[model samples]
Structure formats: structure tokens, C-alpha cells
Target: MRRTPHCRRAHQEHLGKGTPLSVIICDIDHFKQVNDRHGHLSGDRVIQEVAGLIARQLRAGDPAIRWGGEEFLVVVQASSGVAMGLAERLRSAVEHFHDPEVGQVTLSLGVAEILSGESIEQLLGRADGALYRAKRSGRNCTISAAGN
Candidate 1:
């Protein structure tokens, strides 16, 4: 999907001003197993439902995108603490979400705040690292980037 010019400009503005930005990457736990047990249709439904829940919880300036299958990225114009709070809320929302077909679902999340002069890849890598940590520690939890 094409990102709107406004969104692009906003990103550029952040880059220009060297503003700190926070990002959260979230993924469902055992998503493939859910698909295998409940069928692809049910899996898709769960994904959509979780996406909606995350979207609803976003702040006015925040944006949430479906990064990939069973994965989502949320951008928040706030500090790392705010980003972590948002991630925790999203995790809780998904955990408590009700679906007749899929029942309960859990999520693993990674959060990071962009540092001055940091590249997008670097920020993403930090968040990805945190996400892997969350998964390794045990699914259904939130992990912030190391040293954040």
C-alpha cells in the first residue's frame, strides 16, 4: 500500500528535527499452530481482530500497520515509556480478546525509541531484538530494547 504524502512528510519532519520516535513490533504466539488447529480462516480472523484492537488503542498521532503475517508495527510519537505502555496495552487486549472460533490469543511485543541520528534499520533491529527476547523468555510478554 502506498503511504500518504502527509505520513511521508511527517516522517521527514522527524528526521529533520532529530526527534525521538518510539516503535513497537508485535507478533502473535504460536500463530502457525493456531492456523493448523483451527484452519486458515480462523487464523485470519484472529489476526484481523487483534489488528483492530491495537488500532483502537492507538493515540491520536500514533499509527499501526500490519507489518506482515501475524505481525504488526506501531509508531508512537512519544518516549520509550509511552511506547512500552502501549505495547503492554496491546498485549493485554489481545490476550483478553474473545473469539468463538479461536478462543484466547496471546502476543509478544518489542518496543524501542529512536535515538538521535539513528537510522530506521537500527531502530527496527533493536525492536526486533527485543521481540526475539520476549519470544525466547516466554511468549505473551513485552520486552523493551536492551539498555532502553
Candidate 2:
């Protein structure tokens, strides 16, 4: 599904309007393995539960979107540090989240701050690179792409 207009507007307001924008790209760790081990139904339940948890934790100004299968994007009106904190919190939440059918879920997150004159593509690229770093270093952690 496409991202809602509200989600798009929030991104514009925060990233295009000169307001500080922090974008995070999160992916479930070993999600494919989960699907293989369990089943598609159980895997879907895990995705839904994690998405719900993220939506509940977000502020009114923040927006979270399911970017694609097993991946989510979070936009927050805050600085880089705040974004890192939020990502960490999300990781913690997923780690501790209990699912009777799927058990615990974990995620790796990549955070980036919108730079001056930067396009959405650039921001997303940075975040995606950071996500790769996080996954390579170890799963279930947050990585920042700023100043690198």
C-alpha cells in the first residue's frame, strides 16, 4: 500500500519546510528465517504487531509507514539524537514484545538527518546505507549515517 497523505504531508512539513527531520529505516532481523521457520500467516502477524507497536509509540507529528515487506520508515520532527533515541526505543520494544504465536521480534534501524538542499532520495539512501551497516555490525541495533 502507498503511504497515506498524512504521512507524506508530515514528511514535507518536516523535511521540506526547513524543520528538522529525522528519518529512520527499520528492518526485521532475520525476517525471512521467521517466515521459513513458522509460516506466512505467523510472519504477517508479527509484522502487524510490530507496526502497531510503532504507531502507538509515535507522536502526533511523527509518521510511520510500511515502506515494503519487512521494512518500515519512520519520520520524526526532531534532531538526529532524538531520532537515534526513538530507533533505540523501537528496537527495545520489539525485543521485549511478546507474541504467543511468533515469539519475540527484533529489528535493525538506520537513522539520518535531513541535510540542507538534500533530496528525499539522498536521505533515504543514507538511511539505507546505515541500515546495511547496522545489519553487518549486528542486528537489533541503531546506526547513524550523519557525518559519514
lDDT of 2 by residue, 5-54 (tens): 65457568865576787788999999998899999999998999999988
Q: Rate the local accuracy (lDDT) of all candidates.
A: 0.85, 0.85
Among the numbered candidates, top lDDT falls to: 2
Backbone clashes under 3 angstroms, per model: 0, 0
lDDT of 1 by residue, 56-86 (tens): 8987678787888999988776789988988
Error of 1 at 89 (Å): 0.7
Judged by whole-model lDDT over C-alpha atoms, candidate 1 comes out at 0.85
For residue 106, what is the lDDT in candidate 1? 96
Native RMSD of candidate 1 (Å): 2.6
Q: Estimated TM-score per prediction?
A: 0.90, 0.90
